[model samples]
Every structure is written in structure tokens, then in C-alpha cells.
Target: MLRSLDVLLLIFLLVTAIGVVCTKDLLGAAIIFSAYSFTMAIVWQQLGAPDLALTEAAVGAGVTTVLFLIAISRTVRREDE
Candidate 1:
């Protein structure tokens, strides 16, 4: 049962990864990247690495995504100009 869930998480991770890669908008990509982090956290927990999973949940889902958004905001521009 647990292993099955892990497989699901991995699948979700892959889908989110493709979303991140295929997206042309920086903001959209950053949002999907956060989803990637969440799926990764689940995979880590399934692998019996609670510490690493929590780290991913915190940093990957939280800090890293925020940083990516901020960086994108700074470097990317809107077409309204």
C-alpha cells in the first residue's frame, strides 16, 4: 500500500516536472515548481527519510519556491509595456 503511494507521488512529481519545463511563463513555472517540491517530499517520506522529507517540504515547497518567484519577478517583465 505504501509503495503504491510512493509510485503515485513519483508520477505526480514527473507530471509537475514536465509542467515546470514546458511552461513559458516564469510565474506559472515557479508555481508548478512548488508542486514538484511537495511531490518530492512525499517520495522522501515514503523512502523512510523523514528528516529529508521535512527538509524538502520546508525548503523546496517553501523557501526555494519563494526565492524562485522573487528572482523571476526581478528578472522577468510583463508584455503590457
Candidate 2:
């Protein structure tokens, strides 16, 4: 059912959001954040906003994730140093 799917997506979104916050590794956090963004895009689609969903998928999940990963790759963690 659509309602069940919406609930599942919401639950996944919550889990990913918490994963992003609780993750200690920068790379892992970025990955989780991307998942969160992707779930948000699905939610937008379910809400009948395809344009916003497309933008969120492209910018939020795609571009921002890549940028975060690039920034993470260039930086050295204090623990590593």
C-alpha cells in the first residue's frame, strides 16, 4: 500500500538522519547523508512534486554528496594526524 510505503520511507529517512549524525567517520557520514537526501527525494515524489524531487535527487543526493566526499578526501582527520 502507498501508506505503508510512505511510512517505510519515513522510517528510513529517520534512520539515515541518525546515521549521519552518529557516524564518526567523515566518509561514512557523507554516504549516509546522501541516503537521507535520496529518501527525501522519494518523499517529495510521493507528495506530488516531481520537480522538487528531481532537484533534490540531482543536487542534494548527487552533487552535494560528491562535494562532501571530495572535501572529506582532501582533509586529514585529527585522529589521522
Candidate 3:
């Protein structure tokens, strides 16, 4: 069961990473990147690294997402303009 969950989480992380890379919209890509981080945290937890999982969740998912969102907000312009 644990191994299967790990495999699923790995697949989810990979798919989200691809989505982040393939997306043209900056905001959408940023969100996908965050989801990738969340998936990674789940994987780590399944691997019995709770501390590492918490760190990944906080830094990878929280801080990274905030930074990407800030970047998108600063660089993106109105599509109408």
C-alpha cells in the first residue's frame, strides 16, 4: 500500500511538473509548480521522512509558490492592453 501510494505521488509530481513546463500562462504554471511541491511533500512523507516532508511543504510549496506568484503579478500585463 505504501509503495503504491509513493508511485502514485511520483506520477502526480511528474505530471504537475510537466504542466508547469508546458503551460503558457505564467500564473497557471506557477500554481502547477506549487502542486508539484505538494506532491513531493506527500512522497517524502510516504518515504518516512516527516521532517523533510514538512520542510518541503513549507519551503518548496509555500515560499516557492509565493515567489512565483509575486513574479507573475509583477511581470504579467492585461491581455486587453
Candidate 4:
């Protein structure tokens, strides 16, 4: 069961990473990146590194995502102009 979960999480991480890269919209990419970071945090926890997991979750998923979103929000889209 644990092995299966690990595989599932790995797949999810790959998919989210691809999604982030393939997305044309900055907002979509930021959201997908956050998902990827969150999955990485879970992977770290599974590897028995709780400190790393916490840092990844806090910095990668939380602060980084928020910063990306804020930057995206402040930008003017060419289509809108």
C-alpha cells in the first residue's frame, strides 16, 4: 500500500509539473506549481524528513505561490489591453 501511494504521488508530481510548464496562463502555472510543491512536501514527509516537508510546504507552496499570484495579478495581460 505504501509503495503504491508513493508511485501515485510521484505520478501526480510529474503531471502537475508538466501542467505548470505547459500552461500558457501565468495564474494557471502558479496554481499548478503550488500543487507540485505540495506533492513534494508530501514526498519529503514520506521520506521521514518532517523539517524539510514543513519548509517545502511553507516556503514552496505557501509563500512562493502567493508571490507568484500577486505578481500575476499585478500584470496587465496583452489580451485585456
User: Highest lDDT, which number?
Assistant: 2
- lDDT measured at residue 34 in model 1 versus the true structure, 0 to 100: 97
lDDT of 4: 0.89
Least well predicted 10-residue stretch by lDDT in candidate 4? 72-81
* Model 2 steric clash pairs: none
Where in model 4 is the C-alpha error above 4 Å?
76-81
Ranking by TM-score: 2, 3, 4, 1
How displaced is residue 69 in candidate 3, in Å? Answer: 0.6
List model 4 lDDT by residue over 1-81, tens digit each. Answer: 578888999999999999987888777889899999999999999889999999999999999999988888898422234
The local distance difference test score of model 2 is 0.91
Error in Å for residue 48 of model 3:
1.2
> Would you list the C-alpha lDDT of every candidate in the order shown?
0.87, 0.91, 0.86, 0.89
Candidate 3 residues 1-81, lDDT tens each? Answer: 557777888888889989988887888888888999999998888888999999999999999999989877987823323
Note the clash tally of each candidate: 0, 0, 0, 0
Model 3 lowest lDDT segment of ten: 72-81
Query: How well is each residue in 1-81 modelled by candidate 1, as lDDT tens digits?
Result: 567777888889899999988888878889999999988998998899999999999999999999988888888833232
Q: Candidate 4 clashing pairs?
A: none
lDDT of 3: 0.86
Q: TM-scores across all candidates? A: 0.87, 0.89, 0.88, 0.87
